[model samples]
Target: MLTIGVLQMTSGVDPEANLAVIEDAAKRCAKRGALMLFTPEMSLLLDRDRARARAWIESDAPDRVIESLSVIAAKQHLDIVVGSIPVAAGGGKWANRTHYFHPDLGPPVTYDKTHMFDVDLASGESWRESNAYEPGREVVTVEDTPLGRLGLTICYDLRFPALFGALGDRRCDAIAVPAAFTRPTGAAHWHVMLRARAIEAQAFVIAAAQVGRHEDGRETYGHSLVVDPWGEVLLDMGGDAPGLGFCDIDLGRIREVRAQVPALANRREIAKS
Candidate 1:
């Protein structure tokens, strides 16, 4: 069994303040005996003000948040997945990137979010993520972690089954889907989709989410969750507030579920008509 920590946050516009929260969470997670900690998307900064955010977005220099997290990971002897942060992707566009920091690993492994959240909700919230961010093309997975093989994904990437299918094909034991979901869509789809993904992939799904009202005039659905390969919810930190939660993941459950269903083995390629 692997004990993991999930940090649900109401991140604001200040990177310094957000970093402070993460630092404290790392210490708490270490004290709680968690081998790894997962945080929400935009854990560093969640500002709609592009002009103000650009100063912190990494271009020519390394991101300060990532650097700090690396040091913290080593100091705490904990692995941390900083859900997603903005980094310059060249061509004047930034990428929503996930960074995995291991205590022994010299540099973190990274994954850029593949799907963009560009939609007009019934609640009058419209996001044009592609306007400022570039989408990633590669599916990323990490090996030899406390949880065994783990897949990396961010918020909008949850909606794309093909991405999860790829992770399933890779036989990842657990998948990290850190998110900053809007209240309306999250209320309607969050739990159901996470459960479905766990069922389909036959892998544990760990989603640390952003919650509550933010300093940037936005509200997110909290409910940070951990679902087992059997589609059972191991933990759910409800929508009320930002906090840290822990779940014990049984690696043996993956084998047991796969033995019953064998869905991944049954998969076949479809030919275009």
Candidate 2:
């Protein structure tokens, strides 16, 4: 069994201020004896301006954000899972990438978000993430302290079930869905979708979310949660300040649940049946 921390926050356009809050939360979680930590998506900046967002992307090998996080994780001797960072991947395209850094690892490994949230809301809040960002081509899974084989995913990908199936097939013991979900959609389907992923995959689902309003006046539903293989919520924090939660993860439980259900091996292809 291993202890994990989930940090939920209300991030905005200021990177410095957000970093300060994240540092404090990480310190607190480390103090509480957490071996692994996960932060919410957009944990660095939350501006709608495409120009400013583009400027924040780092071109250097050791991006300032990753460098700083590496130092912190090494100092604390903790495995840190950074939510989402704006990354440039050639052709003037930016990818919303999530990173996983272990204490001994030289550099953090990353997974870009595959799904872009492009929705036309009835309330006039339209988003075209694809216009500013490129979708990722691969699904990534990595091993870290406390969690054996962990799958990484960002906010919008939670809506797609095939992603979870892919992770399960890769033998992911836990899945992290770091998000900055908008108020409307989160209120409508967040809980159900998160729980379903945990139930179907039989893997621990750790979701750290962004809450409150942003500089763009866009409200995010912040309810960071952890669900067990049985689809039972272990921890739930509803729109509170940045904080962490702890849960003991049993690596053996993943194998046990999969063996009991045996659904993964039973998957079949339908051919116009």
Candidate 3:
């Protein structure tokens, strides 16, 4: 069993403030023997003003948070999976990208968010993600990691099972879902969906989430979770404040679950009646 860390945070408009939170969490989790750490989406900054956010990104301007994380990863000898950072995409748009840094591997692997969240919720919560960011076309799965084979997905991507199916097909042992979910949707679908993904894909699901209200008047549901292959909720950090939580990722348990069910090996296309 490998120890993994999850950072539950409520990020705001300031990158520096967010970095402070991340740095603190990183040191604490690393000290606690977490081999790898998964942080929440928008770990850098969450600004309602897209214009201001875009202005923060530039070719010369550094992503200080990621830079600091890389250094922290090396110093602590830990693999770090940063949630998502907004970077320059040019053409008057930015990209929501996740960065994974290894203790030895100097450069990080990046994955742009594939599905954009452009929905108008019934609870008066609305997002126009397409207006500010460009969606990614390729699916991503990383095989080389301390926590076995891992898959990456952001907030809205959690609702789409085909992506998780793709990851499972690639034999991913676990999936990381970093989200800043709205309170309503998080309340309704968060727990159910996380468990479903684990059960359907037969992969461990670790979700690091944003909690409470933010500077932009956005309130995220806090309940960062870790679910095993048997659809068990291993850990759910259910607090209104920022903190660190950890879970064990047992590859043998994944093997045991798959051996018992043999679900993936029994794949077949259903015929339409």
Error of 3 at 114 (Å): 0.9
Clashes of 3: 0
- In the range 47-164, model 1's lDDT, one tens digit per residue, is 9888888877854333666788899999999999999889999999999999999997488999999989999999999899999999999999999999989999999899999999
Best by TM-score: 1
**What does candidate 2's lDDT look like per residue over 1-273, in tens digits?**
778888888888778787777777678778988888899987887788878766677446328867888888887888888898787877888889998878774889899999999999877889999998999989899874478788999999999999999998876789999999988899898999999999887899999999887787888888898988778888888874556666777777778887888877777766885
Question: Which ten contiguous residues of candidate 1 have the minimum total lDDT?
Answer: 58-67
TM-score of each: 0.98, 0.94, 0.95
List lDDT for all candidates, in order: 0.92, 0.84, 0.86
Best by lDDT: 1
lDDT of 3: 0.86
Models sorted by lDDT, best on top:
1, 3, 2
TM-score between model 1 and native: 0.98
RMSD of each: 1.1, 1.9, 1.6
Off by over 4 Å in 2: 58-62
- Total clashing residue pairs per candidate? 0, 0, 0
User: Looking at candidate 1, what is the lDDT of residue 29?
Assistant: 92
